[model samples]
Target: MRLKNKTLATWLTFFGGPLGLHRFYLRGFGDLMGWLLPIPTALGLYGIERVQTYGQDDLWSWLLIPMLGFAIAACALMAIIYGLMTPEKWNARFNPGADPEALPGRTNWFTVVGIAVALMVGTAVLMASLAFSFQRYFEYQIEEARKISQ
Candidate 1:
């Protein structure tokens, strides 16, 4: 019976955590992961891109290029963190056979799935934006280099 709320929180975090909903459930764990996770996930992806393109002489500028890449990598790390940190929340959210009377709303599985899907989709969009910014910074570096050569 007491496990019902915890189960719901777990399901919510496990499923909809990327978008930050899981933190809302547990408050402490949720907030901590929410703030910390995305930064790494985004940055990790950026770091990978940096390795791929750092060979270009003009692309190796100090703050402008590396900063963007760092941002992306941090974001990627955060995504992973987000997913990993929410396991407790997921467990709390989806104990299917639990007593409804104890926990209040039965909280249908389909609804949980929907929320998770939305969180994932939202996360994808944010990542895309991060990628776009990273690309834009590189493009700016290319343009700046071209001007210098002229």
Candidate 2:
């Protein structure tokens, strides 16, 4: 089956860019890397701030909580993008021809798995950063309380 003239990739890019559907359509290796870019950028930035402001903690701080929320939003956006980019059915009507340029090649199972793993890792990083940020906030709170008693 094939997907031709649908512009699925373009629509996905506009509606769900944070997930990187455009990159995936282009190919593997790089597609997986591109998929992982956004979440870490946002989460790492937010987590760094939490550490700077709060010091440390075990659960999570109010500031860090927003990071988790943003991660969830980002994941949703990515899912939509990925879903839209994928063809619901690769009908024979969309199969590639001998035109060379018309056919970019096929995607193997390994390629799909790689992209999925990359997406998972990105999500994990965002979650961990959110957790650490909260921990930092709690530590700061405890320190502040001790100082007040002294």
Candidate 3:
């Protein structure tokens, strides 16, 4: 069995958790979600592009927004999970035969970085969601105002 570095796993999951890069690193080709996530991501992008071109009346085209929100949430959760995992548990699960003593201690640079990245990403997603909802609400208000004026 190949020994996986806990730091690397945490970082990868932080950066590419939704894309399954961390999963691929830990589980190789057997990581089905790692390979499959791109499908919806690409489709979501396509849907977004369609919405941009065709307008919001295309409700189905807006599906990409929710898909991307889900991806962001999943990545943030994975980053937190991986960063919080103890080195001993990590070694036990991913590096069974390795000497526990050889492993790094509980806190490390990677964990710090991973946690920071997760927080940043989570905040950005939350802000973007709020902005999108506000935009939609204001647009509806404007439309109602126009209807009332006419």
Candidate 4:
């Protein structure tokens, strides 16, 4: 059995999880999700571009926004999950045949980095979403106040 590096897998998941690079690294070409995730992402980008050109009337473009968000959020969640997994469990699952004595000590810098990136990105996305909602709310309030005055 091929011994997979846990740190490497975690890093790939952090950097390219949405593209399923970590899945490929762990399970090779048999991981269909790894191979297929890019399709919707590319389609979403195309839809977004079309929407930008033609405006909100493009219903497909609006759908792509949620698709892209789900994909990105899933990746970020996976990074957190992988980073938190213990090395013993990782070895048992992914490097079963390897001698425990030969396995490298798991001072995983990749896991640390993955956790940091996931936290920062997740926080930023949450903050941005909240900011956009608040902006819209205030704009609506201002519009209501103007109509009342008129």
Candidate 5:
């Protein structure tokens, strides 16, 4: 029933995306995804705790840490997508009852900033996730090969 501002949506997605705050903003609390988005974020956080407690060498860290990275990256990407949407498209999708040129859907300085932030953060997170997963996997493989060769 209320208007959904593009700037607010973009910022929320960037900041609280893992918790599905943006989804709730646009789609409301009943949105299943809004509730479920935190699962991987929580799991990834637990993975960080595991690494802290058990160290990076722990297999669980290798598996679980990537979940956090991927979740963050995905959220960042979503933020970018939301920020980049055209005013017509944004209004149509999020504020169906409003005018096509509604101010809430209009692009603004804040929206651009949010998009930039999302782009920077998302790319870094994605790269880090890929690097981490590959590095750990190769390290484990090398260890296994060394053990067999011995």
Candidate 6:
């Protein structure tokens, strides 16, 4: 097999992880996780559409929107992991036939940038999802409480 580039994998995970492009690139189409990643991503997109059509008060949309955020956050974290992986580990895992010090596994400026981007994006996404889901849930609870008091 051809040598897999760590920098390329890092960027792919950051940009296309939600769609499983990174996983497929590394493990090929038979990777079950690669095939499954898109399901949540699609559901999340559908949720966004539902919110646009039915508004934020839509229960399904509230539940589903977080899925997309979580998926994105997960992918970003994966990118960070890929970026930080040691050259030896990266080669061992993804380019088993290549030398441990293979050039493709070496860290580069692109990988550093990819790591920074992934960290920033992942943290933002995770925070947003948590904030959104909790806000909606608390509002729902307050509404229920008011109904009981009334």
Better structure of 2 and 6 per TM-score: 6
lDDT of 6 by residue, 56-110 (tens): 8888887999999999999999999999999999999999988999999999998
lDDT against the true structure, each candidate: 0.48, 0.49, 0.72, 0.68, 0.92, 0.94
Q: Which prediction has the highest lDDT against the true structure?
A: 6
lDDT of 3 by residue, 66-126 (tens): 5665676677877777777877777777777787644542548767877888878877875
Model 3 root-mean-square deviation = 3.6
**Comparing candidate 1 with candidate 5, which one achieves the higher lDDT?**
5
For residues 14-124, could you state the per-residue lDDT of candidate 4 as single tens digits? 678767788898889798999987766676677669768987555556556445545666677776776776767666777776665344315366668877888788666
Screening candidate 6 with a backbone cut-off below 3 angstroms (N, C-alpha, C), the clashing residue pairs are: none
Which candidate model has the greater lDDT, 2 or 6? 6
- Per-residue C-alpha lDDT of model 1 across residues 87-121, encoded as one tens digit per residue: 34434443335443433333455445544554565
For model 5, the local distance difference test gives 0.92
How many clashes does the backbone of model 6 have?
0
Clashing pairs in 4: none
The per-residue C-alpha lDDT of model 3 at residue 41 equals: 60
**RMSD (Å) per prediction:** 9.7, 9.2, 3.6, 4.8, 0.8, 0.8
Q: Write the per-residue lDDT of candidate 2 for residues 68-116, one digit (tens) a residue.
A: 4455446444543443333433222233442433422233354354345
Model 5 lDDT at residue 28: 89
TM-score of 3: 0.75
Better of 4 and 5 by lDDT: 5
